[model samples]
Target chain A: MSNNNALAARVRGTVHVIGAGLLGASVGLGLRERGVDVTLEDQSPTTVALAADYGAGRLRTAQDPEPALVVVATPPDVTADVIERALTTYPNAVVTDVASVKLAPYLELLRRGLDLKNYVGSHPMAGRERGGAIMARADLFVARPWVICRDHETPAEALALVEDVALDLGATPLEMTPEEHDRSVGLVSHLPQVVSSLLAARLIPASEQAVGLAGAGLRDTTRIASSDPELWVQILGANRAPVVELLDAFGKDLASFADALRDPEQTGAKRRIADLLSSGNRGVARIPGKHGSSERFTSIMVLIDDTPGQLGRLLTELGELGINMEDLRLEHSPGAQIGFAEIAVLPEVAERAVTDLVERGWRTL
Target chain B: MSNNNALAARVRGTVHVIGAGLLGASVGLGLRERGVDVTLEDQSPTTVALAADYGAGRLRTAQDPEPALVVVATPPDVTADVIERALTTYPNAVVTDVASVKLAPYLELLRRGLDLKNYVGSHPMAGRERGGAIMARADLFVARPWVICRDHETPAEALALVEDVALDLGATPLEMTPEEHDRSVGLVSHLPQVVSSLLAARLIPASEQAVGLAGAGLRDTTRIASSDPELWVQILGANRAPVVELLDAFGKDLASFADALRDPEQTGAKRRIADLLSSGNRGVARIPGKHGSSERFTSIMVLIDDTPGQLGRLLTELGELGINMEDLRLEHSPGAQIGFAEIAVLPEVAERAVTDLVERGWRTL
Candidate 1:
């Protein structure tokens, strides 16, 4: 108890958190679990105090020594100001902000001509549908990508400290330039967000019967449309350059596809449409699923009858066979006692699993 | 065994299947299971023979009586010709073709001045990534929507015959006019397919690093992009009018959204973006999940340690608690022994589940 814990030893002195919202509070809780002393500050005293009560950290005071590191987890619009203030106030401490966009704030700081050697910009690819200090959890950042932006002039020690924090929170730290980070996120995160929002927005004017006919396709495409708009506006605004470019490019693709589909007889129209759709097939195949090497997972269709008893027994037998079911999707007809379950498992065991199930008198597709 | 099965009682006389492909072979397989006399026909003799050997149906013989009902399950482009051939040959039989696009083929048959009373247009909204006789399942249509178009002049018995076939195959039969069906499918299915394909096509030029950062959102939005291009061309071509209109409307939505995102300083620009996103929220809320009433499902996030034992024990306790998990999403960082498992359950039990989990020494978000 007298000695410093593993993380506390390297993270000397108090690690001050300047914003006690979801990201800030989560960072405090995660670090505190590693036995580091965390000091909390927020614009709203009640919010900061609530975070403290929840074991995030206690409020900082004048008597406390200058912190070794300060984490600015404020909203994206105010990130540059917060970082500047932290650097000005704590002259000796390292400063970092968990802003989604890395370039805007970095450029703003550069424009101010402040000595920003201590500042490191980072963004954690993790969030929930709702945002608040109450929604924060110690394990929130675990297994997520935490992108760390570094400059050529930055000292190696400052970069290491931020990476250490990310690792301590159980996140994989990826290093990228601010430009690369913004562009990459614009493609993977911001672009998808805008597209999903637009797709779901189309549903507003649809008839109940039309919406009722919606299957997994529409649902999956629009799931992220539930994200808070105000928060997105801030993120998208900060990364407007890359996001606008991506949206424009995506729009052109949409236009060409529609044109081809509109007049399929206009020489090469059908081929053009097929070529674009085939590109989509190749593009989708590149994404990594939950297991990382997602291509390794294969789905086997198993026939099922209306009797509920068979489902229970099938699950039991899968477990008995030592098959770790990756995912399961069931198709059951309403008022009809027939359907099939599409089960996903590792490919190495897929054939064997099918054979074993068939030997036990199960039908597969 | 000598007597007709439950379904065969209503579906009297021989049922003839045309095309002997995924949909047609599946129809035969399902009807044969009910002891209905089913005969197979296809342009390709080898294909028909393969389907027959698979026990879908036997080849129609010269001595056999005319089929009571004929099902045409050809490609959308050839659907009209096949339906015409079936109607011309089986003059007295009730004829229905399972084509994805209803209006175009229906109009084509009407142009030929064929007898209007005996033909019903239907579509089964069920398919696999790949289509063939081998991929056909007896329960392929189970629990899915089967849209049937009927005109005022059609006989009730002809409509009932088509509906009965859908029911026997474990599908829910829905009645809609050709225009309504075409427009509804354009909104629910075709529009999303084009959007998803175009969104993913943009990824073909994306950097490997950017693609590597892809998450569940990107994957979900692009999943359907892997669909067969040839099949989509035929479906889109057959339903071009409605689909083109939808795509054009969706393009306008994208343009306005991009303009708002591009010029945030413009009056109401930010508000416009927010409103669109908020509309998306409302739109997504209306989609039904696997259980039909998707709103009933609430996800509970549970914190898990790096230890493998904790997961096993968690599953055991969940079973012990009699909590039926609707879905599970695990967020685990590679090389980091910490993550959270998001467990979805019915909302009625969510509170009890959290309480029980906490009492059992499990931490939940």
Candidate 2:
């Protein structure tokens, strides 16, 4: 007992990251990078071997010694079973699970009479369109939000360990209930995927020529549509309640928009379009600016020619003007003579940047 | 007259692109890059002078000699009047207008008994989130489609000149009636903006803490929501009818989805989500692969660490593998131990690249 306290005081125990998939392997790799001893495991021996081979973690078998913390990184469908098994298998270790949706697993654990004291539920608000262990990276959690859904019964030590892991991974931790996490994710993540996919689906029957004319707008709107169907099926399935509620409200707005369009005289159509478009303005205002600040961006337009090196020239000129571009976009019409380059800058720098560009003999509109 | 025909025979007369904004300046720049003699005009002396300064075209005043073709590149609300004025001012010149919506101006021209023989209506399927003449580029239309709406009365010479213009700008030309063009754009362009804006609007009421946690999924879904409100307001206002119709259909689907969510036990909800998701799958299928081909992309996942040089190393290694990356994405979660890196390559080369990476001791999941 004295030795245990001594070890805990000097260093956190080895972290055992289970599954060796994107999240699991990343956890192991990140902990290892932080000088924490990490052991990686997976149901598939080949996967476990591959993960270790890639330096995510050292391999650990079921019979291996218990570690200080255990992270169950698996699909939502199986997270609960994995967590229960981990708890039973490593009674001395603090346990956690990183899954997209939370309520179901938490409920399942309660039903199974698992020790709630050792387990903290977490959802890392980061992911790519691809999946699997191969996609794991040590810095995946850096600067992103990690939500910890804590219950009253969660042990303080376990919570502290998890927080330490999150901090070590360079993540900003937020605290919320399982329900709040589910609802928030439903609105921000799951609903957007559904909407994007639906919009993309509309193009299925489009003529090759029409589809060919697609620009960055369609690409951006449908990017999430390319996500794996099976995984999303599970995600949407688990978060159906909140997702459904959000979709319903969206439907009302869409219906109102449609009604306005169908008006014979355009009076109602203009109002509807105005309302919808204005709503977007308001919505955009709510988004945090780059680097988590809320400051609005000022857009400046620069005229560019339809020639090679022109864009490079403009960017170089902007660099020379000392304009730190927040965002940049280009507008071109097929068979048109010129292209428009729109650059977003911090609101404060917008006027100076515009004046500098104008003085440099570049058109600013 | 002989000199005019001679010039028209060997080389097209100078195409004057008016307004020099995103659309107008692009037209001039595109033609000039194709070695066509082009003149640019705009009401604002500063804008006209800037276009000349950028080499998009030479500045021409109202008193200047007419060109063979004149493109009225202006805002939608003002396009018809410009077209009418251009026709009157340049009686010998063939005329066209580049606007987002079509039916309104065509109708207005027809009602005013303008010289339809010299004029055609066109909408280029290209744009950026930003606006204005200064953002113009010469190759913005490269490989994109330009839709030209023509009636029986459109002069053959006028149509030919417009087609030449589109080709010169490196755009594919498509012919359609005004109604067809409006309906098509309504589905592909206008509807997507409304949906995106509506989705973004939901974020307005969300807690700042939650908004700060957003990742690329939310960003992609809401990117277009940051579009210029004044310009969109004009586009939406003009194309209300068809946009409304599409939104109604979307609303119906959304309602069905909501019903399914309200009762999870019902297969209806499962089917709804599945159907919506599947629709996205089908829609994604319609998008052209990289390099404007229809081939499927092969996706590969690689594990990366959070260190500064880790991503660069992976990319460099992939380059060493002789694998050309078509697209790449990274997912970073705040307060987590790892991240994900997804890469897309040609389908035929996927396995070879994956094997090479694995041999190089990189994790493949």
Candidate 3:
């Protein structure tokens, strides 16, 4: 391997990645891109070989020198065992696991009373809808959060090694305790997953006509319901306490919201319903601007023909008009010759942008 | 006035629109585009004049003839009263409404024991995030499903008149009973709104760290939660029964999911959780393609610099490659110099498309 890439300058030895599935393969591919040697291992021989064939890494062998870092990217259920095994196999290396829930595996390791000074727990808040070696990408972690659980006892050198990997892979690393990490993900990730799943599940029994009325709102609220069930089961099981509490609290909110709406004639019922919904406005505003673009930006829809480059030309025209796009979305109906390119810009520029586009012989609806 | 527009060729007289809000002004604008004579009215003098100034329609005058059709586009709470007033004021005209809820207003008008042969209830199933005449678009209803309520007493001419309006505005009209309309929207629209709101409201108490970890999943699930609270409260109250029932069912689903996770060691508990999640997969599949792009398309993210025309150049290159896009989304970090253009294409061509793009010197992830 060439030593010219950036990571090779900092990483002293090979980085061994365990369980060459989506995350592990992605890690290997990204490290290899940075000229660091990587060794792949997985229980499934086919998966490991496939990842290696895709240039993620070469197969691990005894002749290879002991790695400087071992990343355990197994599923949550097997994470603790794999972390323990990796630490034993790579005795001189700093070990880190990329499991979604940090607390359970860390607790299991502590229960065994192993020498854990070299082990770190981290989770990159990044994933695709599907998981496998073929589904992996070198830039999967780009511009996403990678939470690293650090304790006072952890060595500074070990922490730096893990954070460096995140930084090299284009991820921002944030430090949190295992307990805090679990609780935070429970609120933001697990609870939303369950809620979206249940909401989508409601559509299973709906009439075709009802389902046909589905719009962007229903689609947005249920998009994540399509995640892998088996993977979610393991994740929810590992983070049971916080997830359970969140679900229960959410259940109470749903109940009260329903109660207020069911008999809105009650004196305070209408006020309660409005207040709860208003809280949604406030809570959604708390999400960063990109994540809450609908509230923060104005969308102007432009109509275009079915030909290729029509949309590209439209965006280029917007640039020529000096309209700084906050976000852009293109939607096409299968049988329709026309499509909608909904460009979101700051509310201030919207009217003038529309006037400019229309003046320039473009249709801004 | 040009008599050559499409609606002018078919209609007998002017279309009078009551309530110059988002829906009202949009109906007027779309009809005017088709050369229909549209007269606008609103309780607020400023609103009526504003709609007229925006070319949505002309202000109604005492000297005008009775309209051929009266469209009541007021808020749901005032829909029944507006319909009743329109029916009385324009006795010779066919009266219809564009309120989201159908059953409430229809039932209220029926209970009053007035002649109802001229009234038709319809909902265009279209809206923008913010509502006002300023947000009105002539093409807002294009390609959307507009639900029209019909009954034994509803004359064929009245139904035809309402359906013609829907068709003239480029909407696909579907017929259903009032009960069916309410129930269908209850499952697909109202229920999802309440759930999304409550879920987003949960974020109000979350720490900054938790909100900072938010990803596209959380953002998609909470985007609609920013809708106006006052508008939703009235809509929810008007369609209380179905929405309340749906919420109760969803609450039970949430509770049982937590119960399964709370004791997964129990027999079938893990299966229960997995079954719920799998059901979600099936349910989301029920939504049509335009609303459910995640399931139907493969997303390929491409990196681009902040320079103007860089993204446009990338998309224009895709046109040359002959790869048809299913959908496109662009995301930009406010302070970052880079942006991601996530293009969704058919799964069959994804691998070749990526290879071709990489060969062309584009960085894709």
Best candidate (score: DockQ): 3
lDDT of 3 by residue, A27-135 (tens): 9999989888999999999999999998899999989999999999988889999999988887889999999999999999999988899998999987453478987
- Residue A116's lDDT within candidate 1 is 86
lDDT of 2 by residue, A1-365 (tens): 45334434534567888888888888877776666778987889998888898688898766667888889887777889999998998888888888899898888899987778888999877565346667777876777788998988887877877876786677788888999898888878888988888888788777776676666677778988878877887887777778878888787777776676577366666666676777787876666655466566788878766544455466666665667655555554433346566777888988898888888889776
lDDT by residue for model 1 (B241-308), tens: 99989988888988898899899999999999889888888878877665555364788988876442
lDDT of each: 0.84, 0.76, 0.86
Q: What is the descending lDDT order?
A: 3, 1, 2
Tell me the native contact fraction for each prediction: 0.54, 0.48, 0.68
Against the true structure, candidate 2 reaches a TM-score of 0.82
For TM-score, the strongest prediction is 3
Question: What's the candidate order when arranged by decreasing DockQ?
Answer: 3, 1, 2
- Could you give the CAPRI-style class of model 3? medium
Pull out the clashing pairs in model 3.
none
Pairs clashing in candidate 1? A143-B333, A306-A337, A333-B143, B306-B337
Q: Which residue segments of model 1 deviate by more than 4 Å?
A: A1-4, A127-129, A293-296, A302-317, A326-341, A358-364, B1-6, B127-129, B291-296, B303-319, B326-341, B360-363
DockQ (C-alpha) of model 3? 0.61
